[model samples]
Target: MHLVHLTASTLFGGPERQMLGLAEHLPGEYRSSFLTFRENGRCQAFLDEVRQRGFAGEKLRADFPKVRSVLRELTDRLAAMRADVLLTHSYKPNILGRVAARRLGIPVVAVSRGWTWENWKVRQYERLDRLNLRYLDRVVAVSEGQAQKVLAAGVPADRVSVIHNGSRVADFQTPDPGFDTKLHSFFPADTSVSHVVLSAGRLSPEKGFDVLIEAAVHVLRRCPTTGFVHFGEGVERERLEAIIRERGLTGRFVLKGFTTDLDRFLPWSDLVVLPSHTEGLPNVALEASAAGVAVVATAVGGTPEVIADGETGRLVPPGQPEQLADGIAALLADDRTRMAMGRAGRLRMQSRFTFAAQAAAYQKLFASLGSPTVFLQERVTCQQPPSPPSPEDRNAPTRPGRFGSPTSSTT
Candidate 1:
């Protein structure tokens, strides 16, 4: 099958990475292409990677001033590709991609990682996207919490699928000695920093880095030897730096910025923290867990689904610095418990959330829609039903998988 992924992304976040992951790991029977609306900065960077990886892709400069022209061009290009299914990620693509696919009578599968709803503009976009969900042939939510939100928005229960985010387990399982050396170089040779607490993601308000910094202050009072290191860059860098200085946490809390090779660095840390105000099902959490690093994250939006409180890791309430600090400190104080949690987390990741497992689920979704190579044929329109199955094929017992049930929960 020929699948076209449409996205308008300004940054390389979990959703963007997940899209690429799917494209890279999808079965050989399927051919994939990427259509990006924005052609600058991170979007361009994503396109560059897509091209380098030998995927068929196009980057269109879709500016607000030339939206009508861009949309026309997008429709023309999508029609020319003759994709059987068009999968869209992000707000702009979800809204615009669905409209264009409908025009071509092509089926659209929209992905909803999570809605930011951080501000009025984001809320408006999310509201519009929620309304647009009704028109999509299928809507995949990363977490059960997100799936619930989609159902609440009046989408048919049968139309939504919950597929958790996954990561490369072996990458995290294999230790890198060179990265350990680099990690040590970041701290002084004869100074404190016994415990490494990592927080990675874009430095945005929705990520709640400020709340983490506040929680760090409290954590330091109890465990001063601990070092809080954050990865990734964003618009809030200056503000976050100011807070670190003003709070006199410049030494304890370190912002490492964006690192392309997370596998090299993530495993060196003692534990991971995700203080996001909201999330769908963060790939970072899965990466951390796969690395055998215990997580302390907010119990919001599918987090509890991943973290079994006091089992795999701790889950604190959102925006609560006190609870966040306590959760971190408690885990840090008990080495045995922390190590056990990390082991449990790794098992969970390997058993339920590997990249291979995720790819298989998506492949099943594509096959259920139609034949694997339906798009390759000229006469077979995307909307047409496949040829009637043989009696034996119809009687084949259906195996249970991620999409076999209405709601599949790992926890």
Candidate 2:
């Protein structure tokens, strides 16, 4: 099978990382490539990562002013590639990719990472995404909650699939000694022993780093030895920095912008916190679970699916600094409870949420649609169809499906 993946933005985040990871792990028999929008430095960096994994990637500069011409150009390119499926990520590509693929009668699978209505512009994009999703063959939601939202947005329930984001356990299972030493260097010379609280992601408004700052004030008043650190870079950095200064938390709460070495930091953390106001299925929490680090994250999106309330981690209501403070403080105050939760979290990750498991699910989805070299499935049946089937589909028994893929029988 041949697959072409579409991404609107080149910024490296959870969604982008997951797409690249899937491309890397997919079955060798199937050919997969990337179609990226935006040809800037960040996009170039993303291409570098893709090449490192030995995947063919192409970037098209998106000029919104010439959108009609751009879509026509992209549609021509998609026809030339002869890919059986076009899997799209993010709002822009999901909207535009579907439009281009539909002209050729090629199947399009739209990935809904989560609709965070952080601003009017984002909301507008999501509205367009919903409109586009209704036209696409399939919608992959990262969380069940996100799947519900897609259904509510007018997409048929039979057309939405919940595929939880997966992470490599080995990536966070071991800590680099050199990187760990560098992490220690960030601490103040006067501090001999301190409880490290870590949070890492894009420093965006929807991430709720501002709320985390407010919670940090309460945490510091109660526990002075706790050091709070966030590793990410975004437009919210300046605003968060100003809030940290205004709250007089320069020493206690630290912002270490965009560190690629999470293995170093996760090992050193006493506890990890995700104060995001919204999420699909956060990769950070999954990584924390893989590292066996106790997590205190807001009860949002598919977090409840990953975290078993009091079992693996504590979940607090979003935007509640007091409650966020309480959850963090509770985890930090007791080492026994915290370590037990960490162990449970690691066990949960091992049993589920691995990269291999996620890849298998996607491969099944692709196979059920038919081989890329053959005619695509024309029907929109939610279950596996009969007759001149794809090799994988003919050999493997059909499992219950949550979504339908675009299928057209070969004569």
- Superposition TM-score, candidate 1 onto the true structure: 0.87
Q: Write the per-residue lDDT of candidate 1 for residues 1-411, one digit (tens) a residue.
A: 789999886665667677878877887988999988764555776777788889987887664447687678778888899877999987788888876776666778888888876668878988999878866778888888787777666565556787777766777657888987677567665656888888898887898999999999999999988888888988789999999999988767889988877767888888899999988888888888888889999988888878878888999889999999999999999999999998899888878876666787787677666642443342245445333335564344432233333333456
lDDT of each structure?
0.79, 0.77
TM-score of each: 0.87, 0.88
RMSD (Cα, Å) of candidate 1? Answer: 6.5
Instruction: Kindly list the per-residue Cα lDDT of model 2 for residues 11-77, writing each as its tens digit.
Output: 6667767887787777788788888887454677677777788888888755455789779878987
Lowest-scoring 10 consecutive residues by lDDT in candidate 2?
A: 402-411
- The per-candidate count of clashes, in order, stands at 1, 5
lDDT of 2 at 330: 87
Candidate 2 residue spans exceeding 4 A from truth? 191-193, 370-411
Cα displacement (angstroms), candidate 1, residue 20, comes to 2.7
Candidate 1 clashing pairs, residues 3+ apart or interchain? 232-257
C-alpha RMSD between model 2 and the true structure: 7.2
Worst 10-residue stretch by lDDT in candidate 1? 398-407
